[model samples]
Target: MVCLRERMKMGKRSEWVAFCFLCFSLSLQTIQGYKESETARTLKLEQGDAHEVHCSRERSKAAWKIIEEYLMPFVEEERYQISRRCRLHSDNDLYRDQEQHKIHVGVNEWQCGYCRKRFYGENYLDQHFDNRHYDLLNVSHSRCLADICGALHCDLVMDSVPRKTKCNPAAAAKNQHLCESLADTCFPVNGGPSAGRLHEFFLRQFCDAHTCTGGRKPFSRGHRKTRSIFYLFASILTLMLLALFYIFIYMHRRGMKGGTVELKRISKSVQKKKPS
Candidate 1:
C-alpha cells in the first residue's frame, strides 16, 4: 500500500512537470509572434516613408525638366522683346525732338530734383532717380503698388494709383527705364552688358518671391575667390585620402611578407629536426 501510494505521487509530479513545460512553450511562441508582428509593422512604415521620398524626388525632377525645357525659352523670348522695345523707343526721333524742344524752351532738361543733375531725356532722369534715390522713394511712398507693370524699379515709384487702361508707349518707356536702372543696380557691369545679362537681371528682379531670392547678392570677385578656395581645399583632401590608402596597402603587403618568411623558417626547422 505504501509503494502504491509512492508510485501515484510520482505520476502526479510527472504530469505537473509536463503541464508547466507546455505552458512555457506556449508563452515563448506568443512572445515570438508578437515580436514578428511588431517588426513587420515597423518595416511597412519604413517602406511607406521611402516610397513617399521617391515620389517627391520624381516630382522635383519633373518640375526642373519642365522649367529647363519650356519655361526658360519663354523667359528668354520675353526678355528679348522687352529689350527690343526699349531700344526702339530710346532711338525714336519724335521722342528725341520733343525732349530737345523741352530743353530748348528751358523746361529744366529732365533734371533729377534730388541730385540737381541734368539728363538729356526722361529715361536717363528715371535711371538716376532709381540708382540714387531708391531708398528715399521707398520711405516716402505711403502704400505699395501691385506688380502689374513687370518693372524692377517700379517699386521705387511713389504712385499707388491703379491704372484703368494698358500703359502707352511713353509709360512703357518709363517702366523700361525703371527696369534697366534696377537691373544695373542688381547686376553691375563686370565689363559691359553682354548678351543675356540684362535678361538674367530682369528675371531675377521680377520672378515670383517663392521662386527667386530677389537678387540680394550680385555675383562678384569675392564669390569667385571663395569658389576657387573651396576647390583647392577639396583637391588637397582627395590627395590626402589617396596617400592614406597607399600607406595602408603597403603596410598590409609588408605584414603578409613577414608572415610568409616566419612560416618558411618554422617549416625548415621542423624538417631538420626530423632528419636528425
Candidate 2:
C-alpha cells in the first residue's frame, strides 16, 4: 500500500511539471510572433511622419498595361479608358476639344467605389479618384486598385527611396519607424527632364520629408494697435455724430409742438374775451 501511494504522488507531480512547461513554451511563441508583426508594421515608416512609402513602376509599356488592368476594377472602366486616352492630347487640345466632347457626351456624376460619393464632372472625378482611391504611396498605384492597399508617405519616398537615407535628420529622428528605401526605382511617367523637378516640388509640399519647425505667424504688433485705435476713434466719432443728429431732431419736434400749443391757447383766450 505504501509503495502504491508513493508512485501515485510521483505521477501527479510529473503531470503538473509537464503542464507548466507547455504553458511557458506556448507563451514564448506567442510573444515572439507579436514582436515580429509589430516590427513589420513599422518597418519602413519614419517615426514623426505619416506612414508612407514611395514605390515607382518601371517605365515600360508592360508596367502601364499592368497598372491599367489592376486599376479597372476599382474604377469605372469606361471612364478610366476615356481619361487615359485623353492624356495623349496637348494641353491646348485637351482644353479645347476634350472639354467640349466630354460635355457633349453628357456631364454625368460618377460615384467613388470606396466612399460612394458622386462627383459632378470629369475634372472633379479625376481629381477625386487620384486623391481618394489611388492615394496610397508605398504600393504601386497599380497595386492599389484593390480595396486593401498600403499607403506610404510621399515624404518618405522623397527622403529615403531616392537618397536611401533621411535627408532631414529632425524628421527622421521623430519618425524613425516610418522611412524605407527602395533602390533605383524609376518613375516611368516622369522620365522627362521636367518631371523630376516637378515631382520634387510636389513632394516637398505634401511629403513628410521635414519636420514642421515653426509656428504660424502671430498678428503683428503694429497692425493690432492700428486696428484698436481705429475702432476707438470710430466709436467716439459715431457717438458724437449721433448726438448732434438726435439734438437736431429733438429741437425740430419741440419747436413744432410749442407753436401748435401756443396757437390753440391764443385762439381760446381771444374767443373767451369776445363771448363774455
Candidate 3:
C-alpha cells in the first residue's frame, strides 16, 4: 500500500509538470506570434512609401505621428545616413538547406559600410554622425547623395554614366524659339490671338517662380506688337463684315423702298438681282 501511494504521488507530480510545461510553451508561442505580427505590420507600413506612409496598427499611430511631426523636422537639421533594407526570411534564404528554416522571417541589420557601426532599426542610423571618426561615410554617401538628387538640385542624374555632357545647343535654341513664340502669340492683348492662350496662361501661373519668372514684361514685347497689330486688323475686318451684315438685315426689314435705294447705288444687272 505504501508503494502504491508513492507511485500515485509520482504520477500526479509528472502530470503537473507536464501541464506546466504545456502552459509555458503556449505562452511563449503567443508572445512570439505577437512579435512576428507586429514586425509584419510595421513592414507593411514601411512599404507604403509610394504614398504617405502610416502605421497599420492604431496603437502605433500616435508614435508615427509624433515621429513625423517632431522627429522628421529635427532630422533635417542634423547630418544623417538613412537606408532601407528589406527584412526577409533569411539573409541567405536562397542558400538555406533546411526547408523549415528557409521560410522564416529575418530582420535586416544595417551597418555603416564605412564605420562598420551597426544598427537594428533604420531610424536609429538616420542621424549617424562622424564626430569622433574620420572618413566613415563611403557607404552611406551613395545613398545620401541619391536622396538629394533631382529633389534638391536642378540638375541630377540617376544613372552612373551621364547620358549627355550638356543640352544640345540647337535643341535648346529651338525650344527657346517655340517658348518665345507661344508667349508672344498666345498671350492676350500683346500678340496674335491664339487658341492656346488659356493653356499658356495656366502654365505660366503654375510654373516655378525660380525657373519661370512671371509678371516680368518680356523683352520681346516690341516684336510681339507687330502680331498684335495684325490681330487688330483682323478684328477690324470682322467688325466691318458684322456691320455690313447688320445693314443688310436692316435693309431687308425696311422693305422694297430700301432695296430700291440700294439698287440705285449699283449697276442695272446687280440691281435686278436685289430682293423684291
Which candidate has the highest TM-score of all? Answer: 1
Each candidate: RMSD to true structure?
33.7, 20.1, 24.7
TM for candidate 3 is 0.24
TM-score against truth, every candidate: 0.28, 0.25, 0.24
State residue 258's C-alpha deviation in candidate 3, in Å.
32
Model 1 residue runs over 4 Å out of place are 54-62, 70-276
Please give, for residues 103-137, the per-residue lDDT of candidate 3 as tens digits.
11225555654446776754344334322222222
- Deviation from truth (RMSD, Å), model 2: 20.1
Number of backbone clashes in candidate 2: 16
Better of 1 and 2 by lDDT: 1
Candidate 2 on 82-192: residue-level lDDT in tens?
223222112212122212222212337655445556667666754654444443333322332111111123322223345444346565444322211110121122445
lDDT of the structure predicted as candidate 1: 0.47
Candidate 3: segments with Cα more than 4 A from true spot: 50-276
Give the TM-score comparing model 1 with the true structure, all chains together.
Answer: 0.28
Residue-wise lDDT of candidate 1 within 213-266, one digit each (tens)?
233321111111124555898999999999999999999999999999999999
Clash pairs detected, candidate 1: none
lDDT of 3: 0.40
